[model samples]
Target: MFSSGDLEQAKTNFPEASSRDLKGKLLLPGFIDPHSHFGMMISAIGQANVAPPPAGTVTNFSDIIVALENYRDAFGIKLSEWIFAWGYDETQLAEGKHITKIELDKAFPNNPVYLQHVSGHMGVANSVALAQGGIDENTRDPIGGRIICFDDGKTPTGLVQEISMYYFAGKAIEEFQGKKAELFPKAQEHYLSFGVTRAQDGMTDLLSMAFFRSLAAEEKLDFDLVTLHGYASLKNDDLEFKTYKNGLKVQGIKLIGDGSRQGKTAYFTQPYLTSVFGCEKDCVGFPHGPQDELNRLIGLAYEKGIQIFVHGNGDAAIDMVIRAHEEESKRLGQPLDADRRPVVVHSQFVREDQLNKYRDYGMLPSFFTNHAFFWGDVHRENLEDERAFFLEPHS
Candidate 1:
């Protein structure tokens, strides 16, 4: 939609992944930060949509079974083949509970099912899916993840969190790879139709990043992919940090300090109003990794001069990120306000004191303000009034 001069300027400001050939299109559009998980969203375009109202009609467990059943029949899903569905939220359900192995076992005894949570941090797996992932009662939780179990604390309820859910998620992505030729164009069009020429593929694991690289090499990827390497994948020394290959770029490392606030897994200074699963009492939620590990990861990124994006929704988790930044700044003999431009993604429920620290540290607190409209009531029920009032903390 612009003249030659404007098109050239747009190329200078943004990655030219907009269209290898726009196939005779107009000028570029304004940039917007929608915080999309570009790669997975592309894959999920074909997955059964079990998201709540305005997206899907799933309101309860029975609705979930019916939706999955419809999808299974529509696709003629083979016996024991994986059945994947996205966007199920316990808070949105009538029962206000997680879909566990029991319900999934009854609905599809032979098929392996994986229901992705609305928050990408966790998911529910059927017994078949759990077995396929080799997760069971005896399986211990991964360092940065939890295997939510029943009240007995021994039997897994088939709800896996954080790093523990990688196996199933990775498998789903692998399946997407099988359909890339067909899905990639449609997926790219879906984003481009909204004038979204750029997108963030946050917290990408090693396997997914490799797959993206392969696509780039083959000239199959069409949009700018600004990726954040998952903290666990930071150990891969071969990654080309701060560089672009085709449209895919490894922008920085992402450290998931805690889970979503609505899920009651976020790390906060005060205890949650209600008790959560897997915690005995005073459930304030916990960090994905230990304190020392956080320090180590931040220090490593600092040493490499790699920008960081920390996912910290709760106040305590924000404190952890601030402390790590301070320790790293000291070791590097750099002031906190140096032009590193670190980002604190989803600074939800961030405290006023944390806001001061963020200013001093020259950090960008990317507040996802839509939570105020989407999960405001849940936050009120879970957090004190003062904390709920400060949600997103935009000036």
Candidate 2:
């Protein structure tokens, strides 16, 4: 579309410019996923698919049980071997209920079965799996987690929520040692196909970081990987940030302030319209810790010069993060560095006031807008029209 004189002038002005002729073609920029769990997604690919439509298409409770049993039988799994499955949702099932420990026990009496909730904040374990984890009725709940018990309040229903799933699911993952070398490359290829040149492993522990470092040493990766080291993994004083080979960098630290809203575990200022599975009315959910504890963690990360990404899906949780940032800024006698860009990940239920606070604190919100499409109807059911429509509001 340029005239001959204009083209000559452009070439004279920039001799280094190289031109590509494309009469008819489509061109776009590469996608950058700011917040995602690349390692976890790779692991899930190797596990059985039991999620509902689009992800797995397992529609009902019966379908889930059949899928797990089939996977176990096809793999010739021994009775002593553990069976782990992900992508199970109670709301999506035909029965409109969660699979209980009793049902899993009946299906796999010998094997220790662990079925993770689609929300990634909870999971269900059979009796054998519960026993293996030493999680009996007598065991107290962890700081930010809940062991959903039966009506008796003494008998665990095999459902674990929030931080409780971390321990049980973590032990299961330990069994799959050295899998990163095999799975990560495949995940990278899949990302490339989608035009994503840069990816983020939103949460990483020491073990995973060491594996990534080893991969870097071997020069196995082709794309860039940025990891946010989990707070739990940084408890040791010796561990510090370092850039490894193959463009892998430890960028910052991550903290989970609350759980998933779909799973009804995210802390909120008000209760849900309907009670959560295995929970009573007026259940406003819970936070991972008190304000003081959150303040301490944020302060520590700030002192270390690490950017913090706090996961706060509900308004109450976001409030905690805002308060912590404010306290830390005041304590340090300075405002947050805008260039560092502390983020509130998966901020699904933020209110109008919170947006102003975020601007005042120089904080960024990275919303999981996909929830608006995949789980919007379910959210409406739980929150009612008045509150649900306001979820992830852009204004």
Q: Pick the candidate with the highest TM-score.
A: 2
On lDDT, the leading prediction is: 1
Q: Candidate 2: global Cα-lDDT?
A: 0.83
Model 1 agreement with the true structure over 180-233: per-residue lDDT tens digits? 556667877877787777778886766667778888898876677788887765
What is the clash count for each candidate, in the order shown? 3, 0
In model 1, where do residues sit more than 4 Å from their true spots?
Answer: 1-28, 214-222
Candidate 1 TM-score to native = 0.88
Residue-level lDDT of model 2, residues 1-395, one tens digit each, is: 33345777988877887887767987667787878888777777667788998888799877988999888888788987888888888888888877889999998899998988888899999999999988998987889999988898889899999888887778756855567667777888898898887788988866777887787777876777888877875566645564544778877789989998888989999998877866677888999889999999988887766788999988999999988888888897766544457899978888889888777767888857788778899899888787799888853
| Poorest 10 consecutive residues by lDDT, candidate 2 | 236-245
What TM-score does candidate 2 get on C-alpha atoms? Answer: 0.92
Q: Cα RMSD to native, each candidate?
A: 4.7, 3.2
